[model samples]
Target: MKKISIKIVYKTLLVSTLLTTFSCKKVFDVKPQDQVDITNNYRNVYDANAAVIGIYGQFQTLADRYIILNELRADLMSPTANADQYLRQLNEHAETTDNPWADPRPFYKIILNCNDAMANFDKMVADGRMTSSDYQQRYSDVGAIRSWLYLQLGIQFGSVPYVTDPLTSIDDLKDASKFPKISFDQLLTNLIAFMGDGKRYLDVYSTSVSTTGATNTSLNTTVDGYATNLFFINKRCLLGDLYLWHGDYKLASAQYHYVCELGSLSTNGSWLYDQYLVQNGDGNNHVDIYYGNSTDERTLVDNNNGGWRAIFGGGVGTLTGQEWIWSIPFDKNFLPQDPFVNLFSNTGGSYLLTTSQLALDNWNSQTQQNGLPYDARKLISVRTINGQPVIMKQLYYNVDATSFLPTSVLQKQGRWLLYRGATNMLHFAEAACNDATLGTSGVKLAYALTNVGVTRVYDNTWPAASSLPTDRTNIEQTFLDAPYNLDGRNGETPYYRGLWYRQVGSRTRAYLQPLPAALASDKLGMETAIIDEDGLELAFEGQRWGDLMRVALRRKDPAFLADKVYNKLLRDGNGNAAAVRTKLMNTANWYMPFKL
Candidate 1:
């Protein structure tokens, strides 16, 4: 199947922007009913296609804010000279209502677009202009996208007003009390419901127009052109993520396992990819995940060439990696341009920067000092320039290895890969570990070793599969004694009989990063191990803060939340460690308060 390129057009008509930052002065210029040409605009399949593309366009605009707020607020990133006041404030955990990135407007705007597209297409179907299957496909696509946006909102802000219908009038905002604030748990429930409907309407296997019996014969003929596009959001992937967040471990595992199962199939359809996305030196590492081993116009890198950097911005021109299940598309010459490439790349105008010791020390400890071989992630994720650590995760433009590129070139190539294969695999591991009823120490350890120990460990010197102990006490003790084992990148010697990530680093430095509060005192070593692995595997991907929040909230450990940030402050000493620790220790500080 051929991949579709997302070309953004900025001729969208805003339905209602009253009392919001994105609201235009012309909000009243267009009539409530005639806000957009819904009746006339969606008359043809081409027009309907334009509307769907516009929905993805909204995601492009959201790329910068999504990354900035999620990452800058975490311990992994701190502000540099390029940072503005708003950026600095966010790093300091002092968010204001006026902070543009913190505002929920972008999320709501995308939801409104989804609502508009779905409603107009429904009318078209009712009028016999569109087919029933076509309507189902479009409805499914829009619902899943909306649910994805809602999940982000719920994660950032605890209780937000759940708006299902489009707001057509200023009166809708007049009565704030009418809008009910949905809790994070309740929001996940609603999102699950949305995923259910989306899955029912979407096809597991892509079909041609003749096979689908669709009225839009021109576009729906191939799996690539179908309205229920596999590239936008995979229903099972979305469902699995939702299940994981909802604490339904068995259900989450089932969904992720299904994805993994499909990857192993020889004749799998468009819904699942067949190869691993990123790999280490040896092909044995991170095996059996989804990816594209071949190269075409859609993707620039092939099996022999690409790894993490290639999958992201290994100087590849296209965002067509098979591992990318869902992503916000970018056009270098469009209204909503990409920002990450420049933000991380531009040494001339750097906005976000790497913390001095957190990443560098981590790289040294694991790659050089540790008995295991060097991890490839360190080379791809961070590099030291003029004795300062800088992030190199998503630099799209070309640059010399030691120096930062100019921002102008960086902005021209900003692209964001939202979801990938490794993300799904790790989620599966986490779900298994956290599963209350179905989880056991052996099961969790097995899942962890499969994803991290065997697949991601660089030296491939992880303990033999037969050596891992089945008992929980033995596993805990094995980790506590990991630092003493000195087998370096060689499987010849019998070593620690437990998970590969048993001893991440010395106790003093590693504790600066948060430990999962849910872990027992005996299993606390695993907390630092998980945090280290997550940092290395998913670094510069906008997940650090949320990961900390999840563990902190679940364990209710103030020290866990305070330690990482406080340690950073003590190193820099710009802010008072006691004040910052006090603020973060408070559970409320974990999330940005709802500010519409």
Candidate 2:
């Protein structure tokens, strides 16, 4: 592979600079300006603000390729006929040097921007141009973003040239002597250290000031008169992910727990649990199903669109929902137009990709809590377009009632969901389930998170617990004790019911049945269930491959990932399924070739 120069990599940066006057209303609306030397640009707060937005502008360019690499390479998505060889090669696991998505330059460009910003921020703080408080918030934000980008690079490319210093030329990267390539494990270690224990970094930014009148401004603040935390990365969430990939389950659980607790506090307790599925007066025993006036279970009625669908399509409210912790928004009016419209939409897009049969079959194979066939999230997540299954999560806010298609493509504005509530809860459960100290109790909590709420898991009368030993009552009470307990029933506080009292299991929220009690003590079984639940709940959102890779690596079982991708290919009728599986079994074939 030929080495590319930094000049060629960030040519766009040289042609136009993000020098627009800072406006809280137009947070991401960067305008083109004649090239100015960025070396002397970091002098004040507004400059820091512009620098942060500029970094995000570069980061926005990554949305399309990020989703393509993460999803298409996994089992949930496949290239469509319209897709070019570049995309098809990804699904086939045969990507060559020339594939556009295979290039690491785009990721490095954002890292470069982050590096430059952080270096300058440090200088500003030392020279007294930026206050320590201001530096702490902005510097940490840029650092977390950099960590996230590198993690993505590691996930896709196995070993990456981990460069920290802002490079004067891309040629420096070509010289392995200067920037030695680091393996994914090494990268995780470096990032974990960089992110620290999450104490020095500022938590969620607030709109309010301290009693001393010290401003608490951060990238999480409202933009365009609307509250938005989507533009910035969540520090704890990123740190937790780093720890998770590094095999530090206890630390990972703690970080994830912090995010969950913070979410509850920030949302006034309504954010931790999944939204309730109200059971209308129907003869059905399920909370999610509606049978109209008929008693027959087969009778069809209107499907409730607001339950899980609202998380994506609930408009501005979606931004504030507890589910979304970190996301990146794209506006058509902006430099990086909404990428998914072209990638996922058939009407207004080229439709380069579609939901794979494997994903569809996986959803269909599940039984809902109502004993109904298929999960309801499938309806909101995927839909038929021109007789092909299109991924609807990114394109539409809601499905059309009559056509069952997207009401319209979100052409003007769309979001790249990076982290959310399910991510926090499930990751915590995974860490707990794997931790040696937590044992079967940990497995029980993990099942509760995936199936039903904690209340039902601890219920002695619940059928699933009837087989347990009589001596287990005391152990179960410890789980229901203060601090660790999460009850789903109304309590003494007025807001208690509104908060956690309405809690349901993550899978339960999707109308899926809980895992049988037989697997509660089975660590591998619970881990597998958690990973599968990840797919059912968060599929097609750019996390499939990472989840598979992390688990496969932890267990030292290459077949874990190979089998899934292989089965997906077989389901898609791809002739390469056997070949791909054979190659993937070696683990070395899991990553793309590291070419410039």
Candidate 2 lDDT at 135 equals: 86
> What clash pairs does model 1 have?
209-221, 286-455
lDDT by residue (304-349, candidate 1, tens digit) is: 1343354555322222343555544444445555566556654544
lDDT of 2 by residue, 270-346 (tens): 33443221111232222233345334444443333344555565456542254677776655445566778888888
Worst 10-residue lDDT window for candidate 1 reads 12-21
Clashes of 1: 2
Misplaced by over 4 Å in model 2 are 1-34, 197-199, 209-217, 267-305, 318-320, 398-411, 464-500
C-alpha lDDT of all candidate models, in order: 0.53, 0.70
- lDDT (Cα) of model 2: 0.70
List TM-score per model, in order: 0.73, 0.86
Can you give the lDDT of residue 368 in candidate 1?
A: 21
Give candidate 1 misplaced runs (Cα > 4 Å): 1-35, 169-174, 197-199, 202-207, 210-231, 265-304, 314-322, 347-352, 367-374, 385-388, 397-411, 441-528
Every candidate's CA RMSD = 10.3, 5.4
